[model samples]
Target: MGHDRIDPEGIADPVDDLYSQVVVSSGEKTIHVAGTTARDSDGLVVGETYAEQIEQTLTNVEASLAAAGADPADVVRQTIYALDCDAFVEEAYPHVVDFYGDDALPASALIGADSLADPDYLLELEVTAVLEE
Candidate 1:
């Protein structure tokens, strides 16, 4: 692993070191993924609550990564966009922890959006992965 995680002073360090304020990685191949949402293959949205939506969205992200010959462990960075940050932090973060697991966690950011593409859509996920030569 050639990834370096930085947590500078004055910034609150993340719990469990699951995420870093900054992450740097060097690899022969890199994958950029578009924002993934909770919609299933049938074009129907999944999940009634934010946590459910998060799980579905992460699942979609995982599939996308796999399609690119990568996986969660290859992810160097991840960004989450949500309609409700408070609810997501309280209700959804735990699920995210379970989704990625401890060793597979990557550098991440969470953005609170006013709304998503659809009113029923609660969140979206985007990720970048690296594969060393």
Candidate 2:
């Protein structure tokens, strides 16, 4: 849990409540999670809308972090991919902030992908977290 989120003094702060300009993690254990899509335990794609897909995908990310003994607040970096990138940024991005609350949002990237592993898949998430000793 030893980390610092920087917005930098000179740069225009990011408008989305999604990420920081930089994240510095000073911890012994780091967890690298693979990109995860909005698939349920049955391996079925969940949600048809962008918001639902993003929510389920973030929920999956949270589960991955918990299994690794890390919390969302410990996340140092996050990369999100969406098949409908424009809609994701414009409509669905704000929903994630509700999950993370208002502190230490991870340094993030939102990418547009032509497709995911499944045609029904709309969003995927990957994160790196530093576990507090």
Candidate 3:
């Protein structure tokens, strides 16, 4: 398995490694996680605030990664869907940075959306990863 993160010289660096400019990876297996939200084990929405929901969402993503025999470092791409993009960046981004850390940051996109599958859901995460078989 191999994974290489790249930030070309011309492109300005992302603040605090929030994401990579490009991610090149190869492995025996690939994991594609569906959009995950801040729902708990009993199918209840987890948090009231954006930060709290983001934290729980990340936890769900972590669990999905583990179930696929992968980890944060194995993640190559991530798509974040938020009801409020600005709030996500301002209030909830810290939790994301803490979850992935600087070294394991993946190529990511944060998208603003008006609604989700559930009314209470504030954010959703979709992840793609690679791992050795």
Candidate 4:
């Protein structure tokens, strides 16, 4: 596979590997996806808890990327919206691990809101990917 890795220079503190960077470059085709929530493929609400919804939302994103022939490594940017932003590190971290892996995660901006479209909806995530040529 012909590809180039995108490296991020700012680490602020400790990095397991100095050579490690964030994001990767693949094909010329780029996919930009809007924020996907725990809503099912049919756009119906799913999950009852914050964590479950977060994972479901990510799974949705994963499937979308795969459908476009991309993987988590192909992700260039990720953005998440939470009803309660403060709960992110504890609630959504695990689900996010699958995307980040052993390497640095993508550049992300998380937002907090008083609520979501549905009171049951807890989290939503959006992603951008570059498909390898």
TM-score of each: 0.88, 0.92, 0.94, 0.77
Global lDDT scores for all candidate models? 0.84, 0.83, 0.90, 0.70
For model 2, which pairs clash? none
The order by descending lDDT is: 3, 1, 2, 4
* Clash pairs detected, candidate 3: none
Stretches > 4 Å off in candidate 1: 15-18
The per-prediction CA RMSD against the true structure, in angstroms, equals: 1.9, 1.4, 1.2, 3.7
lDDT of 3 by residue, 1-133 (tens): 6688899999899765689889999888999999999998889999988899988898899999999888888899999999998888888988888888888788999999999999999999999999899
Tens digits of per-residue lDDT for model 1, 21-121: 77778889999999999999999999989889988888888899889888877888889998887888888888777776765677898999998898899
Which ten-residue region of model 3 has the weakest summed lDDT? 14-23
Measured with C-alpha atoms, the lDDT of residue 107 in candidate 2 is 87
Candidates 2 and 4: which is better by TM-score? Answer: 2
Worst 10 residues of 2 by lDDT: 95-104
Residue 131 lDDT in candidate 4? 65
| Candidate 2 local lDDT, residue 60 | 89
Question: lDDT by residue for model 2 over 1-133, one digit each (tens)?
Answer: 4678789999989766467888887888989999988888898888999888888788888999899888788888889888877899876788777766668688888888998888898888888988766
